[model samples]
Target: MSKYIPGNQKHLTLNDRIYIENELAKGTTFKDIAAFLCKDPTTISKEVRTHRLSDWYHKGTFYNAKNFCIHRYHCQKTNACGKILLCGIKCASCPTCNQTCKDFEKERCKRLDKAPYVCNGCTKKINHCTIAHKYYYNGRAADRKYRELLISSRSGINMTKHQLHQKDQIISPLIEQGQSPYQILTNHPELDMSVRSMYTYIDKGLLTARNIDLKRQAKFKPRKCHKTQITDRSVFTHRTYSDFCSLDLSSFVEMDTVHSSRESNKTLLTLFFTKEKLFLAFLLNRCTKGAVRLTFDRLEKRLGTYEFISVFENILTDRGSEFGDPVSLETGIQGIQRSSIYYCDPMRSGQKGAIEQAHTMLRMVLPKGTSFEFLTQWDVNLIVNHINSTPREILSGRTPYEVALETLGEDILKAFQLKPIEPDKVNLTPKLIRFNH
Candidate 1:
C-alpha cells in the first residue's frame, strides 16, 4: 500500500508574500514560485488573484484605465452618454464609455486568466499602452490586506456600526492630536476598552485617524512603520535624460513651468518643440500636479489621442515635483496611450535649452515679480498667438506659426486657435493683451 501523507498546512507569512512579489516581477510561474514557498500552486494563484490591487492606487501609479474595454480601439459605437443627439465622436474613445455604454465588453488579459493573474511579470507592457491594464500584487499591501481580513473575520470585539461611529467621534480627534492610546484610555474611563482595542480599531481603519497618525504617540506595543507606497516603480525608472538621449526620435518637445509672484497662485506651463522651436504656454490656476494633469487632459481632449500621441511623442522636462505623476499625462483617463515624459537630471535645467530660450521671450512680456492672478486663459492665448506669429531670425525670417504649419500641420495650431499676425503688427509687450484684472 502506498502511503502519502500531506504536511500540516500553514498560512503564508509576510516573508512568503514578499518573495512571491519579487518572483512575480521576474516573470516566475506560479508553479515555480509555489515550489520555493513549499505551497500548492493553487494557493499562490488564489493569493495573487484575490489580493492583486487594481489601478495600483497603493503604489500611486494607475495603469491604463481599469475598465479598458477591449473594443475601445476598434469599436465604432457613439454617444453612450445619450445626453446629446448625434454625438460627434465614437463612445469607444471616451474614458467613461465602459461605465455607461450598454454594449461594453471588458477585455481581460488572457495571460492573467491562468497561473499568475497579475501584470507584474508582463514583458509586453513596456510602454504606455492603450489596453485596459491593472492587477499588480505588492507584498506589503497584500500582507496588510490579508491581516485586515483575518482580524475582521476572527469575530473579536464585535461592535455594531453605530457603536463604532460613536467611539470614532471621540477617539479619532484625540488620536489626530497625538494623544497616546494609553493616555486617552486613562483620561476617558467611559471609553470602556483596553488600550489594545483602540490600537486594533486604528489599525483596521475603523476610525478617521489612521495607523500612520499613531507614530508620534507613545505606544505600549512595538509599532512597525510601513512607508507609504506610491507606485511599485520610480517615475524616472526608464525616463532619465540618458534614456532620452538613446532615442532617435525625429522630433522632441521640451516642457517647463514658469511660476508667478507669491501674490498670485497662477503659473504658466510651457512646451517648446525643439525641431521647430514652436512654443505653447498654458495658464494654470495653481502650480500643482493636479493642475498640470488638468491641462494635459484638456489638450488631449481638443486634439484626439492619436494626434496627441504623434505630436507629443516624447516630452523632455526638468525634475520638478509638479511633473512627478506621468501616467495621467502619458495615458488618457480612458486608458488610451498618448505620450511619454522624460526628466533631466537634477540641477540640469540646460538639458532642455529650447524651452529656456522660449522662457526669455515670455519674461519680456510678463517679466519677473508679475502677478498672473489677473490673467485669464483668453489673455494667455492672445499672448501665445502673438508670440507664435512673430518672425524670428533663427527660423530663416519665418514665424513659429509658419514653421508649425508646414511640419506639425495647421490642424493642431488651429485647435488652440493659433493664428498668424502681420510681422509689422506683431507685439511682444505687457500691453499685448488686455487682462480683466
Candidate 2:
C-alpha cells in the first residue's frame, strides 16, 4: 500500500514540480533526489533518458514535448536510408561498386561525407553504429491453458485388447448393481462404450467372474461342443444318441464330469436338460456303480423317478465310465427295465448335444478343471439349483424354475428336494466324492 501525501496524486504534474533533470545537469546524483522527494533513488534514475541533450529540453535541462516525439520517431525508423527508394533495403551496399557500406563505410563516408556514413572505409565501425535490431512478431499466440484427452490422436483412439478386457471387468459389475453405463461413464468421463460392446461383455463371462460379488472380473468365451461321442465295448449293441434324431424338448439330458483338484480321483456328475435347458448336479464319492447309483437315487428322491425319466426319456452321456452299467442302474432305479442311456461317439463330443451345451453354463459357476475334493453335497446341490433356475432363450427366456413350474405345476416347485436357498446359506461340508481315473 502506498501512502498519499496531503495533495499528491499519482498523475500530478506541474511546471513548478521539482527539477530533478536540471539537478543532473549540475552533476547532482539520484541519491540527492531520493532525499528530496522521499522516494526510492531508482525512481529518479528511471525518469532520466540517455538520448536527451541539454539543448533538446526546456530550461536547457528539462524534457521538451516536440523533441521527445522527434527522438521517438527517429529511433523507430533509425535503419531507414535517406534514399526513399531504399527505405527497407536488405543489404546496406554502395550502388557504385556493390560493396556493403558496413565493409567500406570509412572511405565511402569521406567521399559522401555530406551523407549519413559515420567514417571512411571502416566496415566494423559502421556496423556497430547501425540500428541493427530485428523485430519478429509471432502471429499465433501460445496456448496457456493445459489440457489432455484420455484418448490420444496419435494412437487413433483405439484401445488394445487387453485394455478392453480390463474395462469390461470394471463396467460389468456396475451394470449388474443396476448402474447404467451412461451413469458410470459420466462419472469417469473417459471410458467409451458402443451398444455392441456392452452386449458382448454381458454375453461373455464378464458378468459373474467374481466369487462373492456381481462384478464381471474376466472375459468369457463359449465352450465348443466336442465333435466326438463316447464309445463303450460293453454297450456295442446299445443305441447311440444319434439313434434318436429329434431336437425335441425334454428328450435328452447332457452329462459331463466335474473333477476335483484331487486329479480324476473325485468328481461331480452334472446333468442338463436338452430342450428346457435345466441343470442337475450330483457329487459322487466315487465314479463307480455304487456312486452313480447313489446319485441316481438322490435324483429320484428329489425329482421323483417317474418325473426324472419322463423329462429325459433318454440319457445322452459321454464315454466316461462313471455312467457305467446303465441297465443295472436303471433296474436298481426301479423304473423302466429296458436301457435308456446312450453314449457319445468314440471321438465325437457333439453327439451328446444337450449335456455338451450344459457344460458352458456350468463353467460360469464351476469352471472347468476345478477340483471338488473339498466340496459338500449341499454345495453341489446349490450349484445344481442355480443352473436349473437360470433363464434360457430356448425356454422362451423363462427360467428353468418357470418351465419346471409350467411342467410340474407350482405345487411341486417347493417339493423338489434340490431347490436353492441363498448362495451364502449353502452348507456344503466337503464330502469326498472319489472316482477312479
The per-prediction tally of clashing pairs is 3, 30
Model 2 C-alpha lDDT per residue in residues 120-207, reported as the tens digit of each score: 1224433343222111111111011101221244333255777777786677667668665556676665567764555545555454
Error of 1 at 319 (Å): 0.8
Q: Score residue 335 of candidate 1 by CA lDDT.
A: 93
Candidate 1 residue 222 Cα shift, in angstroms, is: 43
lDDT of each: 0.79, 0.50
- Residue-level lDDT for 249 in candidate 2: 35
- Candidate 2 wrong stretches, greater than 4 Å: 1-232, 246-250, 301-305, 333-339, 410-416, 420-437
Q: Candidate 1's residue-wise lDDT over 1-437, tens digit each?
A: 11111112468879899999999999998899888777889899999999998763222112224445666666777787888797888775566777998877776667777768888878875454444456789999999999999988986567888888888888989977878899989998987999888888887778898877886543556766431223434888999899999997768989999888879878899999887778899998766667888888888889888888888889998877678778767878579878889988777789888899888888878898988988887888878877888778989988888899998887898876788878887788877754333
Residue 220's lDDT within candidate 1 is: 57
- Report the number of the highest-lDDT candidate: 1
